[model samples]
Each structure stands twice: as C-alpha cells, then as structure tokens.
Target: MPSQTHPIDPVRYGTEPAAPARPIAAAPSAVLSAVDAHAEAAIALLSDLVAINSINPLFPGIDRAAVIGGETRCTDLLGERLAALGAEIHRVAPDPERTNVVAVLKGAGGGRSLILNGHLDTVAPFTPERWISGDPWKPTLKDGRLYGLGSTDMKGGLVSVVLALQAIRAAGVRLKGDVQVHAVVGEETMSHELGTSAVLEAGFTADAAIVVEPSSQPFPLSVAPVSAGNFNLEITVRGRATHAGNRGAAIRPGGEGASAGVNAVEKAILVVQALQTLEEEWGQTKSHPAFPTGFFSLVPGVFHGDAGVPSVGYMADKATVGYLVWYPPGDTADAVKAEIERHVGHAAALDPWLRENPPMFDWKSNWPVADTAEDHPLVRTLVDARAAVLGPIPRGRRETWSLNAVTDASFLEAKGIPTTVFGPGNLRFAHAVDEHIEIQDLVNGAKVLALAILGWCGVAD
Candidate 1:
C-alpha cells in the first residue's frame, strides 16, 4: 500500500541549504512507516537487479560478448527509477559501455551530506547449473530468501538504498542534507580506477559514505568500520637448466656438484616455506583491535613451473608462485612488501645458487585499507539507527569490526570520506553458486538505512 504524500513545499525543499536541523527530539515516524509499506518493493527491485546479466567483462575467462554491456543497462534502469523519484542522475563510464551511476537526491539544506555506495557489477556465474533454481538470472523466492546472482554480494544492499530513497519521497520527507546513491561498475575486478575511485575523481563527494557491502560478521549483519587490505604478489625464482642425465652430478659430492643443473621448483619451494615461516611470525605479531587474533595472513593461491615449452628430459630452469596477502589496515603496502622481501632475502642468502640469483617480485592489484573510527558521527548514527530498528541485538551486530574481505569502501575511506560497511546478507553466499538474502533481512535493512539517512542528514523543520 502506498502512503499518501502531501505536495512538498518549495520553501522547505529547495536547491539551497535552509538551516541546520535542531536537536532531533522525535523519531521520523512517517519515513519509517513508508519504508514498512514498501518493504516488498525492496525485494522486487533486488529481483530486477539480479536478473540483469551485469557480469564484469574484465574478469579472466569471461565471455566479453555475453556480459560486456550489461552494466550500462543497469545504469540506465537505475537512472530512470531515481529520476522519477526526483533525483539528479549522473552516469560515469570510465570504459566503453561500462557505466557507474550516481544519483543525487537534494535536501532542504544545512545538513550533513551522505553517499550510499554499491557496485552494480557481479562476477560471472561459472557454475550456473549448480544453482538450486537452475538459472542464475531468474530470481526465485523461497523459504523467505531471494536467490539469484548478485542478490547477496550486493544487489540486496543496492535495493535497500533505493528503497530508502523511495520511502523518503513517498513520505514527503525532505532531508536537510542531500543523499547520493553511487551504483558502480568493475568492483568484481577491484578496478576502482573505473568504478568507485573514478566516481570520486569525477567530483562526486559527500561528508560521509556508507558502502552497503554484505556485512555478515556472522549473520544479521555487523557494522564494519575497517576492512583489511590485500595485494596479489607474484614471485619468480631462477635456476640453471641441464639434461636429465645430469641429476646424479647435480647432487653428488664429487660429480660436478657446483656446476650441475639446479631445479627451480625446488628452490621456489624453499621460498614458499620461508614465507610460510614468516606468515607464522606475522600471525604472532600483526594484530588489530577490530579483527580476530592473527587475522592477517599470506595465502598461496597459484603455482606454476616456468616451462613455456615442456621437455621432461630437462631440468626446469625457472618457476613462479602467486600469493594473496591480507594485511591489517594499520599497515602500508610498501611496509608489507619490504617485510616479505627482507624475510625472503635472508632465507635466500644461505643457498649457494639463490645467493647469486635472488627471487624477483611483482606486486599487482592492491586494494587499499578502510579504517573509519567506530565513534565517528556516521558510525554512531548507524548504531543509533540499528538499535532503534533492532532492539537488544547482539553486541557484535552494532559494534564496529574489520570486514574479512575488502570492498570499494576502501576507496572512499582512502579519499578521506569517513565511511562504514553495513547492510544485509551473508558473505559466504556473495560469489557462491547459490547467492541469496532473506526478505525479512532486506526489509529490516531498508528500514534501518532510511532512519540512518534521516539521522545523519536531519529533517528540515
């Protein structure tokens, strides 16, 4: 059922700021009531967003022809819906046909501005047949959860933001500060250059931001004010190749042992072992208040023997190892790199071959850290909204913690805009075969976000 809204008064709702809101003495009952009425509409919008095949084309092994331009269509759809609700829409395409939409809904005036951020891009569904519904794009509602691709990782969060704006409009509520919704592309690749960072670089800014990333710090969602940083590290080791028949000479005490062939894979293994030892050291030393003890870790993701053309009769000359390293927000990428390099360097020194030919490193695609204070106004406001919407919740749900995964929130926080991650859904389902979010959770998220908006932006009296 739609709530009746009186025509907005121009004097109260205008392009310019009016005056700062006085101390909020009463709750905005109308906005909360409107969000409840349109609760189902939030689920419907999530279904629509999930149905779009907006898989990022930049992903490895993705068929560009099948998913290249889907993001543009999403932007178009979001633009139309927001425009109809009196928002000014801006679409950013850092790459061709890959668009990020920023919709700005003006406020009455003199309130803190806010940005609600979400990514429109999703990873391709590699195992679509594995989905219970048999189709990744066909939204299904069963047992109170909406199942579909991007439904959790974050079409649900995006839908919550849309519902918040819709309810505010439907209730004829004009905020004192403007609210901006940034639906971005390329997040699946962490290509912030073409997504979240690009939006800010293009001059779309606010006093604060909320990245509605899936926040299942164990169910019902937690407010995450910090997210660990990560980097893709590739290490290459070199060795001298020789005929397989020289194996005996390579290791024998007197059979040209120093001059014989060296195996790169074995040397790479030493490096990996040394790094594992260093990882244990990190586990003991690197710690943050917002994260679990020993949360920072170095994980080896891929390994390859440098054999461009295989000839089994020969000793391998080179090898490469790929690693994903997660570091605490309190540290810098350069510092972590130096630490690993120092450890590896010391380990390589004792080996005769490695001493002369050291391992090479290539750091790629680093996601920056996000560390907003828990007591910041934006976070405090979100806590207030959460408490009011969900009475007597678990301490973890309202307290700030470090998200185990990184998000575009890093970009916003890096740019000095205080930001936090809070929304509905479990991360285990984000990029999994059967992604979903509960309908009740979705409704509750929308309600909470609506009030948070009013709390932060204030109401013009």
Candidate 2:
C-alpha cells in the first residue's frame, strides 16, 4: 500500500503569539470547563476498561480467554469511536484470538507522525483473598482512588490516551501532523513475539512514541536510557547412592576426616555462596544515571531441590540451584550468559564434589535496551508542553532506570523510533493486591498528553 497524504494549513495549526513575559494565570474558565468535561469522560472510560480483566498468562485457559477477550472488545469499541471521529483504524492480529488495534488521526500537513502506545494486558491477580475490600476484577472507587486489577499498572493511562484524543476531537482542534493511538497486547510476560513486535513488523512507523506506564508522584516525566537484561543460572550437584549401613564406614576419610559420603545440598550451598560473593563484588562498581548506584544484581529468586524417594536408603542424586541475574544496558546478552558460565566454571573448579557434579546455566533474554535522548524534539516538546500546562517544571534527571521488566516500548524502539514511557498512577501499585489509580492523576496525565500532542503536532492555538 502507498502512503496517504492530507492537506493542512500551517497558519491554522500554529500557536498564537506569546503573551507579554509575565506569569500566565490559571486556565480560563472555558478551558477548565473543557478539561473537567473530558476528565469526567476519561474516568468513565477507565472504569469501563477496568471492569474487563485482560490478564496474560503463559497458557490462557477458558477463564483467561474471557479476560483477554475483553481487550478485543475494547479495541473494537475504540475503533468504532475513532472511526466516528474520522480516524483510520487498522487491526493487526498475530493470532485469530489476539489482536492489536491502531487508530490513525491524519493531520492536514502530512508531516511526521506521533504514536501514543499502551498495553492491554495485566499480570494475573495472585491472591484474590488478599484484596481486602473489593474483588480484583471489579473496579471500586474509594476516596479519590479507583481500585482494581490493571488500574494503575496501565488501564488508567490507556484510558487517558483515549480521552485525550476524544477531547481534541470535541474541541475541534485540527492537527498539523498525524497521531496514532496503538493499543497492543502481551506486555506483561515479555512475549514480544506476539504484540507490539508484530505491529512494528507489519510496517507501523512513527517519528516518536510514548508508552503510558505509571509514573511516580509529581509525575516527573521519565526518559529511560538503560534497561537491564534478565538471565538465570541452574546448578546441579550429583552424588553416588551408597548403602548407608556399611559402605559409608568402609571408605577412608580423604581430608579433615571427611568420607566419600557427601551431602549434595551442602555442596550446593557453597556454590550459592560463591555466586553471592561475585554479585557483591560486581555490585560495588556498576552505576548509571538512571539506575541506583550498582554494578548489577544477582538474586536467587527461585531454587529447587529434588531427590529420589527413600531418602534414608540412597544418596541425593541431584540438586538444582537457580539464580537470576540482571545485567546493565552496556552489557551484551552473550556476555551476561558467558559470565554465568564463568561462575559455574569457577564453582566446578573449587570443590571436587562440584567437579564430579557439574552445574548448568541458561539465560532468558529480555528486550534489548530502549532509549531516547533528552534533546530530541519529541522530548523537548513534551517537556515544554508539560511546563506550559503545569507551571514550574520540576528538577530531576531526565532519564529513567529501566524497571528490569519488559514493556512494549522495546518493540517500538527496535524499529528506530524514539520512544519514552510516561503516564499517571504510581507503578508501585501495579500488580499489588489492591491496585488502584488516582482520579486526579489520570486527569492531569490526560491534560499533559493533550498539550504535548498539540505542541508537537502543531495544532492551531
């Protein structure tokens, strides 16, 4: 298909002349009225989205499908709304059961495009019993917070994007450059092969993109520079089964009055200790502006020990130790894997018991580092627009440290498009027992988004 072009008038899309250098007063009554009206609509949309659960699991069962299916319904409903507003809608489905929706609102100028991206999936509710006051799937508005699964993690941010677009439409604002609203899936589990990755591969291009991830209070816009890669190591210790009744006493002591009868668990513990030492050493030096001062992190998030039945009659056959490692952005995936192998190699060499019982290691590659510069036009426009909308810009580093968790931003960045993550809500609330988002934060985020789009796309003042 060929590119489509739309005619635009620059004079109509450009901002009005700046007022004399003086403090601008609060938003005019009319502007505030418009914002309030749109905010009400945004809250309604967020509540609706929160009502539908879109939890992504490794193997989704019928119940899970019902949840994911809601994403499809949301996309379809959003598509119709965008189409009614004169935007072109494109639906991309990797599987017949899973779909990604893109709604493009063309500008008259036909200049560069901007993308507002959001994911439709949330981590499954771990313990519904722990949800003190309300059900995890049903949204509850208490005080100023809207609670439910996916409320803060990002359904609120997604709804904000939709509301921003709707507000612009309602205000009769015409844009100079196109805007694309992309709602994708499979972000919770790093299954890039299925969601935004598919959308980019299908030829979606934008000059810049913003992922609506929850940001901390004061909503300091974050531009992530480095992301950590995830890897895992598995160590196995093997021991010979011997008759505990007499064979153990027959063997002569080797060193320190120690016999051949060895405890595999003890050996595994030594290996774990050595790995911990390595992590401590590495942690002392690795530091990045976005990340906490540290070299990297090696945590034994999971471990497993299995022995054949009849423990008294047989020696432990095998022990498996699992360790997770987070590598900094500059570290190559291959290098991280090699480092794990080296640790295992050192463990094998230190203990003869380990030499006889080898350790195995593997890495689970995460999305490659995704970054955007502070000086980029997209960044500057958003910053300027934010300052314009919310007075007195906050001071902090421009970059954000990757959560070590994967997001759809990876896919868009991989396509050579500049991307950053920003939105409302506190990320700490994400996946929590009582996940919720502040109504005010959601409205403010929508305002920032609307202003940023207007500033970047050159919508007429």
Candidate 3:
C-alpha cells in the first residue's frame, strides 16, 4: 500500500479549502464598557483644557496672558496626557504660540487609517462680565455639565477622542490600522494655513477623518456630511468728492457737474438693495435638504466711508462694503463673485454717474465646501456607532445634515480624504457666553468614537 500522506499536512491541491481566518480580538461590548469606565477621566481632561484660556489671540480684547501663553499651556497639557498613553507625539507650531498637538497610535498594519481632529482655539470672551455661569477659564463641573470657554466649541470633543483611544488600549485591543488625533490652533480665526491645513501639510494623511464639532442631538441631518463654502468680497464705490453744501447743486436737473459731487455711499445703498433681492432669489432657488432655507446667503458685514469724511459736511467720494458669501458644494467662489459683479454692473448701468465709475470688486478669501455622501462608509460607521451609543433615532429627525459654517474638516475633504462631522455638546452654545457641554454627552461621544474606531480600523488577529 502506498504511504498515505499525513492528513494534517495539506498536499499541493487547489481544491483544498483555505485555512480558516483568525478572529479579531475586539469585542464591541468590552470596548463600550471600557469607555464607560473611563468617562470621569475624560471629563477631567476636558476640565483641565477648559481651565486654560486658549483664546485665539487674533481677536481683540483677549486677555494678555492668553495671548502670550494660553495655547502653549493647553498644548502642554495635551502632550503630557498623550505621552502617558504611549502615543507618539508630533508637535507643530504652525504660527507663533499657536501650538498643534498630533498624536499617532500606530497599528499592526493592513487596515484603514483614520484621523480624529479638533481645534485648540476658542473665540475670545465677547463679554466676560456676561458669563453668568462663571469665569471663562475656571472650568466647573456642575449639574451634569462642564462649563467654560471652549467646552462646547471643541475642547471637550478633543478630550473624548483621547479617552476613546485610552479605552481601546485599556481593553487590550490591537488595531490593524493607525489612528491619529490632531489638535490644532487658529480654528476660531479660520486660518487654514495654521490650523488643520497646516497639520495636513505636515504630512499627516489618513483614509478617512472625523471633525469633532458639537452635534449631540440625533435630529435629521445631525451628522454633518457637507459644509457650506465661504468667500469675502470688498466692493469699492468711487464718486467725485464735493462739499455737502454743494452736493444738491451738482445734480440740479442735469446740472452737468453743477452737482458738486456724486455720493458713493448712496450708490452702495443701491447695491445693497440689489444684493438683498438676490439673496432672496437664491433662497427660493437654491435649497439643500440638509441646510435651512436660504442657506446660501450674502451678508453685508462691514461698510467704510472715505477717511476724513465728516459725518455731516462731506459728500463721500469713496465707500467700501464687505460681504461674506456662503454657498453650497459645487458652487464656485468665482461664480458667486461674478454674479455679484453683474449685480453691481446692472445697478451702475441704471445710474448716469455710476455708469462711468463701475463698482470694483476685490476678493479677500475663498474656501470650498466639504462634502461627503451620507451613504459613505465613514458616515455609516458614525451613524451606526452613534445609534449604538445613543439608542434609537427620534422620529422625523434626519440622521445627516449639512453645516452652514465651515470647519477645518473642509481642508481634509478638499485633499480627497473622505470626512464627516460628529461630536458632543449643543452647537448653539459654542462660542457663546459661558459655553458648556453636558457630561453625559461627553461620555456618549466617547463611546461612539471608540466603537467607530473599532469598526473602521478593524482588529488585528
């Protein structure tokens, strides 16, 4: 009889079934439990972050101490905590005193990578005296809420991300892919060159990302898959200068320069009226399911009359009006700008004096929209994880929505990395006096982040 090959030793046969795959060590319940266990610690970290006045110095009337050292204080605290967790830290100062903390938890490889991003800066206290809750920097944990500056805008969200990683590590689960937590500065000032944009430029890339902006409610469109784009425009209206006393004579029935001068302020008012009408038209015509009605708007934010023009006596020869335009994805800044220019041209054509001196437009800045499909895997993972953590969705509440304002996530999405927004706290409270976040919201957000991490990164066998 021919010697029988050992059954255990597989022969070189294509028909043989492949060996069974090894199971990942991760358990959803275990991870969730770990996150719950560490909830207090997460809140503590947030509390510490809140205690530091990391107000963006760009704002006027910021505390001198915060301007000099607040950002560094917050960054140092974050660095210490991340280091204790064994994450590799990459410190970046994109601008002077603007510290960014990026910590990486390397995985065993072969799985998708992810980035959890949050801003380190908060708007300066608009009116510290109006803080009914307490001091903006002296954070307080009271009545199920953590109250202070930056608590809701994003510091709390950042803490939750760190706690989620800690929970994963505590559970002894090894991920197959990398996870990066980036805490950047200058977000409140919307300086892409120094905030998340700088982080990406420093070579922190990932397969997908989550921008932890406050979105605690489970309303329809709660998870922001898209955000409006923005741009600033300055229109210069030029007119012949004349003394106020002589203005009437210049236009006295074809006075032919008898009217001492044309008033640019008057022309600017016409432009404003036209723009208001255009805004209404845009409201009726352009509607996104995720955004509120008339999400695309042109806001006149500032107006400047000619220098040295007295309030009563001078007929202003030059005036400047600034507008901020919010448009949806696929809407080009140039196109919006062109439309505005056309409106100005139309208004000027109707005015004999303005026909010769058409309004001149200067673009200040432009940013594109960050958009992701609701059905994208990243979004699905977040929705599922949120549901798992927060329970069933409320009736008639949309699970996804679009942000009316832009975030640093826009930069990540622009770079081709699919991204979505989710976090804890009431968005209405962000940047408001005595901003605060609910303690339970923090815990729930951490749990969801942990679950999402496990689902996205996968576990190493």
Q: Which candidate's TM-score is highest?
A: 1
Q: After superposition, which runs of candidate 3 have C-alpha atoms over 4 Å from their true positions?
A: 1-27, 60-66, 216-221, 250-258, 395-397
Candidate 1 structure quality by residue, lDDT tens digits, 1-461: 22332222333223332233324435577777888788777777778888999988988888888788888887778778888899999978779679889999999999999999988888888778999899999999999899999988888888888888888889988899999999898998988999999999999999999999888774365788899999999999987788878879997777777478887888999999999999999988999988988889999989877445477787778889999999998898899989999999999998988999999999887988889999999998886776566543442322567788999999998888999999888788888998998776777778778889988998887
Question: Candidate 1 or 3, higher lDDT?
Answer: 1
Overall lDDT per candidate, in order of appearance: 0.83, 0.67, 0.78
Model 2 quality (TM-score)? 0.83
Worst 10 residues of 1 by lDDT: 4-13
**What does candidate 3's lDDT look like per residue over 1-461, in tens digits?**
01111122222112344333223233377777777778777888898898887878776566655475677678778878888888899987767677788899899999999999988788877777777554788887778888899998889888888878888889989999899988888887678788788889889989999998886432411578888888878888887677777766776776657256877888788788888988998888777777877779989999987525557577778888999988878777678778878877887899877788788888987877888999999998887776665443443545677865678888898888999988877787887887898776777778778888988998898
lDDT string, candidate 2, 27-114, tens digits: 3233334555777667777777777767774433436545557667666766776687788999888866667788899998855689
RMSD of each: 7.7, 8.2, 11.6
Ranking of candidates on lDDT, top first: 1, 3, 2
What's the TM-score of every candidate structure? 0.91, 0.83, 0.88
Best by lDDT: 1
TM-score of 1: 0.91
